[model samples]
Target: MAAPARPYRIGTGAGFSSDRLGPALDLVRDGRLDCLVLECLGERTVAFAHRDKRADPAKGYNAHLEKRLKQLLPLCRAKGTRIITNMGAANPRAAALKTVEIARALGLTGLKVACIEGDDVSAIVPMSTPLYDEPGTLADVGLQLVGMNAYLGADAVLPALEAGADVVIGGRLADPSMFLAPLMHHFGWRADDAALAGAGTLVGHLMECGMQVTGGYFADPGVKEVDRLADCGFPIAEVAADGTAVITKLEAAGGCVTPATVKEQLLYEVHDPARYLTPDVTADFSRVRVEEIARDRVRVSQASGRERPASLKVTVGFDDGWHGEAGVSYAGPGAQGRGELAARIIEERIRKAHAVAADLRVDVIGASSLFATAGLKAQAAQDVRVHAAMRSRNREDIETLLWEVESLLCCGPAGGGGYRGAITPCVMTKSVLVPREKVRPTLEVMIA
Candidate 1:
């Protein structure tokens, strides 16, 4: 006889803050969910991680994630709810150790914790390469590789579960893997199960950003009384055996889970509705349907998926060159005219100084037809505010532009008093894009 289906109820907790763990723990303690997913990374988070790694490699892992996890791990163990998260941005091994230490501190022994590695691509970014092949340009233009993390797939999580891991952590795994891991663990779904994979992909997309899927990003006109902006709830999926799930959230949580919210989240960050790519599978978003089942619940079903490719594309950045931007804002009456005059005066000052301000372009905002190429409509208004910005290849040129800008405030326009504040200098950084073929994934099994 086969084991009965272990239908799982999944929910995502608030991100990066230890304060959120209390409420999250309450849900788990109440037996509301079997797994907790957390998302705490973005472009800005990666940038911060880069800075921290430069300052101290030991501090590179997101500290906030550890703090919150520490508070929730004990509760998860008590409630039998496993944890999976993407807190391991630049350092997975270190993060795993920290989680183990937290579990040990809580007196939980034989707790297996796994770290999924091989996502970093900091060293091998090619000098001239785009993120996608020809006809699909959005290459890593000047985006310096502070760090590279591949979105690992669901297959990686099964090993941790097989090893009896109470909690599995990874760095830069696909957003959907957090949800897919539980399904793979329970249903024993193969990687090629298109329908099951599609269900997992849909679940991941719905809860990847936690609150955003529930109602935080919901823009429906029917939900007038619901306070979307305050105390918004994160999404939770009660997945059944037949590759179907009902999306809901914590009771009394402040967000609505209407079809509109689910629809908007389905469309978030998606380029094509037909084929949504992920490391585990290529999900067909068009086949999925969202139905408003109740006041705060929605049913997602009929999702289909395609097979995943063998090799995963990893995003790596390298040092290419340097670039910087500086700007000054002008406000009040006749601001447009004064801004134009100030730009001319600043350019003249740089020319007079014989400074090598290469590409020292100046512009007056709030002026009619100034940015026609950018498709910005020119509108007439009194007391308009103008913003002038300049970009350069080196810090020296930016410094020269800064000095020239100061001179204009003194002699360019009568109302140049808005420029009296101190000028800040910015560093120029460049990024190089590299392919996944250039980097390899390193897998290791460890006991917690």
Candidate 2:
């Protein structure tokens, strides 16, 4: 395969579901990218999408998909930049249809929106399947199974790119693979080439989290200060044919891409430097080099990998019911004592008065919430908030828990004020593995 004349430029538009859109818009309009990747699926996020799908048939994709496509699609069309995303959390087909609709509305005729499906293996994966992370089977979860999706690799996305897709979308597409696929397609890197696969995978890993490499999460007030952080820009990868690349951001934008930030994101969530497993490859970052070529530009190279994993991991999501939290603040000289008293009062009242048999916790937020489970004591503070939280299969139990916390404002501790309560649905997740051959990815492109 022949290499392209120049390095490919790709940028991350989003890292998570609620990432900012302005920075992405900046990348598309000014960064001069060939492709933009928006990775927007987490285990719980997919589970929530299932819940939304159950509520409304056309509502399973990313909530920000419309707004993002509305702004990004036109610019991407004008700039000739392709878009790839996993924003199709629970429904890629629906997301594709929505994108096509948005394109039509924007008068972007002949836009090719591709939807990749078949990541979902809920039908094939049995309840007897063992969990990968902990001891237990899917049946042991004892909650309603929402869905399960296998992580699809770059091969799954290659077809859409080859078929000339303007936008590619899928559910549960492996995060790095979205970035890796374009590199593979553009550079004609073979799937069996472990060395090149590892190189492309490294680029994906660094660019997958959007702003993380650009110092979005690297900001520490004094120790790791990032300049103009409020206007932090997303990352751009200038990737060469040999898998060498420069990690950079728009110089006109905020934040800095130093070796420290690159190294921090390199080890982010990585368990082993030599064997970081993904659906695409078992990448080795141990010998990878990070060098500063210039301001806001760090050249990365020497990433290698072994063959891909034999089995693909699946995220099994279950509906765990409701989660409720309520809090009351106490101020003045004895605020910490009052807050502690309020916590105790709510705990006692919920168990006795409500007879609610549920998982519950009460904490003095300002003084001891985080360290209470560690059996450590916190110093006294004049202002404190008593927070009570619980989870239950029954909505009534959550409501009961919230009532007791609010009752503390008038019935128990003195100086208790600022009472607040909220309830939300909860989903639990577990990991399981399936044989590679059993999971297949399918792609279809729709034109607008």
Candidate 3:
């Protein structure tokens, strides 16, 4: 493949699983995007989908796959825009079949949907796969492991794109790799083109979250003010042959795209600006230039890259038993003291029971629910909500703790009201690295 003289335009559709479908339609209709990537998988989301797969072999893909395809496929096909997504979750073949169903229903023929798989390398991962942020390994993760998938890079999708697939459905690839695959395919970048891959990865990271680069989550009135936030737009990247891009949105869209918004998104979830690791390459955003070239147009250039990691990070999910939480509100004068006392009484009861005190967390919503720290400013308001959350390996422990919190309404606090309580099953995750050679990433295409 040869690099094109003209630039390529790529737009983001859905950022997360529940992203607005309307904004994606807006991009396909007007953004003039050569490709649109709809990212729908997160770390824990795929884990949950894995659990579904365990129950039934064919039920592991993204829940909104059919609806999203029904809404976007016909439009994308008509516009000659290649669509890519990680909605394959635990099952790419299943997702592709659903895409086929959608295409046939819409009377669209010869639509080629590619399903990229081989990211799930649980067989290669050792039983004692060590956790990145914890002391123990998967051995300590005593629950039933639903999924164990590697974060694949964009390299596998190249074959499908080269074979002229219109849509590529991937499972458990890195978030940025969704956009990186299209960029690499369009630019004909070599696997060894670390600089090019790095720049593309940077562009992918900036656009992966969809509207964050378009002012979706960067809003703070009177501080980081954003206009028309109710209908915020998604991001579009105008990529040059060199992999540098201008992050912008659809014309006359609700959200504004500027350098500030791009900067915020660039650093989101990035631990180190010098070495941002991804499946493709290690990106260096430290020396990148951010300039507002035009209204709602931010130019990000000079993103450097290093060699890809020798190993891929695999996220493993296990059943963590149950989580129980309940909250009760206290209003009027002396609400602060009452809320604190209620939280304390709930904690003491759980401690007196068999549940671990360290596994429990109590917060005063009107005081410091966020950050969950002791020194944060406690707002002096007439209303306060006391909340308690507990995790236990057994469901009974959480149920017992939640019962104590619910009891606060009738027996503990003077003005406690609005009692809410619930119990939920939680799937916990641990990160491990598997050798790149172990993951056999492949792309399979389905034609209609």
> Quick one: best lDDT, which candidate?
2
Report lDDT per candidate. 0.67, 0.93, 0.87
Worst 10 residues of 2 by lDDT: 375-384
- Give lDDT tens digits, candidate 3, residues 1-448: 9756777999999899888888899899998889999889988998888888888888788888888889899889879899988899998888898898889889889999998999988778887878886788888867787779999888877887898998999888788988888888877788899999889999999999988889888888899888798889898999998988889987768888988898898899999898999988988999999999999999999999999889899999888888888999998888988999998898888887554554888899887788667567476657889989888777778778777778877889797899889988788888988888878988778887
Q: Against the hidden true structure, what lDDT does model 2 obtain? A: 0.93
- RMSD in Å for model 3: 2.2
Model 2 spans > 4 angstroms off: 1-4
Q: Indicate the TM-score of model 3.
A: 0.95
- The order by descending lDDT is 2, 3, 1
Off by over 4 Å in 1: 1-7, 14-31, 43-51, 104-110, 121-131, 134-147, 219-228, 320-374, 377-393, 400-448
What tens-digit string does per-residue lDDT give for candidate 1 at 271-384?
887788777787888978888878888998888788775556654433333343344556666667666666677777666766564665565555643674686644433444
Provide TM-scores for the models: 0.78, 0.97, 0.95
lDDT score for residue 6 of model 3: 77
Q: What value does the lDDT take at residue 92 in candidate 3?
A: 88
lDDT of 2 by residue, 70-183 (tens): 999999999999999999999999999999999999999999999999999998999999999789999998989998999999999999999999999999999999998999
